[model samples]
Target chain A: MRAVDTGGYLKGRIRREDIISAAAVVYGEVGYHGASLREIAKRVGMSHAGLLYYFPTKEALLAAVLERRDAEDAEREQLDSPPGLEVLRHYLALASHNVRHPGIVDLYARLAAEAVAPDHPAHEYFKRHYDEARVGVRDSFRVLAESGELRAGVDPEQATITFIALMDGLQVQWLTTPDAVDLVGSLRFYLQALLTVPL
Target chain B: MRAVDTGGYLKGRIRREDIISAAAVVYGEVGYHGASLREIAKRVGMSHAGLLYYFPTKEALLAAVLERRDAEDAEREQLDSPPGLEVLRHYLALASHNVRHPGIVDLYARLAAEAVAPDHPAHEYFKRHYDEARVGVRDSFRVLAESGELRAGVDPEQATITFIALMDGLQVQWLTTPDAVDLVGSLRFYLQALLTVPL
Candidate 1:
């Protein structure tokens, strides 16, 4: 058998990462609809065809970009398997992190909104994304409620929906009027309103 | 002197309203980027040139569509001159109203998110819109705080931002998973958490 080209595979993986990073920036600047694959390729200093070899379609590139974001959040924040209080804290930290990185937040806010249409390329992805997100947060709230850390009379499911919505809504407002909106501060206020223990 | 042509003017006004309504549906379906003037004109059963005579540009039509939505909300909910407690109640009602009218909600969510890009046609429009929205909500919360109706230790400005964000965020979530999300219920939950006075 022919020997595998480990160096070429490694280089290909790195090139894919570069392309995804460039796509995230371009998508933030012009939105997914307004973004051009050619521009993203140009940003990464690759030929359009070369970029397409890595990401065969704009939609595929978008998926990679979004996946990379989720992977980063999971890796950095330990968001994949968080405890109840930690979940709340992580979200607050996330708000702060998003404030520091406006590009991905912009990309997310725009794509989430655009994908609400049933026919959008990312529609199923967003629906599943939100479903999983709600379920995860809801479980944390359930844990908080069971331990009496959550405020009395608060439905964990409803609170989860509200909390997720607040995070998303804050992003749009922050993106729109960053000077006027305080993402982390607002999130903390809501958390304080929800939880019995200090975060 | 030329005749005033009152009947013709009324017909023209009616036609313009029809076009705006149709544009709203199209925008909601495909978003602004995916929608076309020709399609909007076709929906209203008018030639594109005829429609352009009224709106001049796609951007102009988008502005009119957005303005009409705001006008409807203001007139129906009396959101323009809202009292402190009434402001919260009206928003809850607004959420309920939005649930029933998915099309408009879809349009607003998509446009608001897309308009976060500075180069978008609706960018300046949304910036001004959110600024005014925050100011309006903030004033109401201020009035509530002065009357001791707002929860103790709740900052009116912070609450105002959270409240606006909640409304916006709920729309996207609701649009994504209408079967799962309760827009009005979540709004009520937050309002109760914020106010000392019962609705």
Candidate 2:
């Protein structure tokens, strides 16, 4: 009996992970508001009921998709520790990488805008995301400042806000006119201005 | 006969303008996709057919809404001449102004994101908007640079991209957590860093 229970739990966990991967693809292609559970299930070769058994609702699947993207990004960048200016550089590289993944960028752009509504399903998720992201960037700046890597009179908190804002703002432009906007060059220039030593 | 023709033309123009105003409000509230022509007509106390006579389609109404917004913003700021640092200051003030008008901001946020898709109705509008905005900002920076107002080695085009990006990015954060993010203060800080003399 104990062996059977363990096997069942493991199978369910694996199934849930697979469903999340498939859902991410769907969400990226059609956006959160435009995507349907039925389509996501079809992509995974599972019935709608099977998908529900794992996610219960579209919002639940969206949360999982967001978490998976974050995790993958962190792993890809090896962002385990505060890498100071290197993290900013990584962000620029990520922006370039994002150009190749239109669906994912669309997913984020659409959801971020939609999540602005107070009663949106992902509102809390986005609120926490910005708060935590701000703090992380702030701490990175503080590290750079403590080491005298940042320019004189630079405020870590303010730099963090500006850095994050520029990143988010550039994505919209890049999505619209990919060739016109040089996302990495713009960010690199800003960082050079902010840093004591040119990145 | 000429007098009557002139009077009828004036009345038609007035009615068209009235419908555009009502449409802006509706689009701002429910966004482009969520809003309906019937709702906009109801808001203006006009028949649906009458509203259709002016707009022809929802896409046409959306185009007018976007144009009206740009016209109003331009008129409000008097952004006709290159004001250099004053442009940055104006942006900060605009951010504050945007807070009071969440509906208009929401309209912009939603439409801008939706317009990322190739076939979206406002796609061309957004593309032209970013291009024109970047050029205008770049020209302003060039003027400031020539006058030795900008910091040494500051690239006018790069600054243009960063400035615009930060403004757009801050809007997303501000819309979600209005109290937490100081949109104007953040822009002011970035501008101070970019300028040779404090504003």
Candidate 3:
């Protein structure tokens, strides 16, 4: 999904992003325990050994996939302190991306849970990501409060982390109970309320 | 850790509760794929088939274990209407419990993730659980708003779902980054802010 950043990297037939994308699919379809390198290689149209030429190992490949998704949030942080409501707008956009990305969020959430084990490939990835996400959202909300746009005493940092939790958590429900509720719409409604509170 | 209210559950050496506790430890130690009936049976001092006497199947046994944790939650809910700062207090208490009951949460999370496949055993269990959790939280928040305890325009229902999401989403974070931050504290601080209005 990335542009030709490198000068036609090895003819671009086997792109780095392509490998990461395929890895994400396998990670989502199968639990990390159940995911097999052979299956991911097959889906990517590479010999099992050939795929290793690109990823080196399944753990490395898994790490790369996780990093690629993490960059999406990092990009949001670069958008120059948009208004608090605007930040919420972007948050909604990212949530939609999760809905469309098909397995990225699920894989992210699932792997995140596993990262608790000290030996997980994702342990460090989650450690730094959580801090950044928590602080970044908090700062964004704080800017809103300073501008006299917040609902007052909103605890931007706290709200920010909690907001992340809500988003992540609802996505879980959506995965398990697609027929039982509309997760996106529900989240959107909540976001709107939090964004605009009447005294 | 319960006293049977004047006359506890048999006041015996080992009983149903002890069996359930042992099952949880085995389940957590090995996971669903790695854990075995023989292991749990041995931990509880019983034959595999004899263990089946109390629980006819492995699945039934697991469900009972999970239900036992949820039962504790229900008992706590009965003790509090959870007004004022207790909103966050309850949230943190719940998170603490989730941490202590890793096996139950881990199993629930795993099954919830797998339930996306449509044929998982915990499919119906999770589907109903999410439905109830979402609707129940929403209704409770609605009551909060109606009673003028909450600021206007905060749709309690949506916020309720949001609260549930926060729990689910952060549990993943807490599992992954247990040492880096206080997950429950962060959420409570946010909820406390959500409740109070600005000067």
Per-residue alpha-carbon lDDT of candidate 1 for residues B64-117, written as tens digits (9 for 90 to 100): 898888888978988877558887778777778888888777777877887787
Ranking 2 against 3 by TM-score, winner: 2
Model 1 chain B poorest 10 in a row by lDDT: B1-10
| Predictions in order: lDDT | 0.85, 0.82, 0.66
The residue pairs in collision within model 1 are none
Model 1, residue A89: distance off in Å is: 1.5
Considering the two chains of model 3, state its CAPRI-style docking category.
medium
Off by over 4 Å in 2: A1-9, A27-34, A56-59, B1-11, B27-34, B56-59
Candidate 1's error at A173, in angstroms?
1.0
**RMSD in Å for all candidates:** 3.5, 2.6, 6.4
For B1-199, candidate 2 gives per-residue lDDT tens digits of 9999999999999988998888877776777668899999998899999998988878778877888888788778755566587776676777778878877777788678878887887888899889878877887789889999999999998898889888888889888888778888888899889999887
Candidate 3 lDDT at A31 equals 64
Number of the top-ranking candidate, with DockQ as the measure:
2
Scanning candidate 3 chain A in windows of ten residues, the lowest lDDT window is A190-199
Worst 10 residues of 3 chain B by lDDT: B79-88
Q: Give model 2's TM-score versus the native structure.
A: 0.91
Query: Which of the predicted structures, 2 or 3, would earn the higher DockQ when compared with the native?
Result: 2
- What does candidate 3's lDDT look like per residue over A1-199, in tens digits? 2556554675554566777778777776776557887888888787888777777766677778888767856586342345456666667777777777646766766666666566766678778777777776777778777876665545566667667777777888778766654577766765554454421
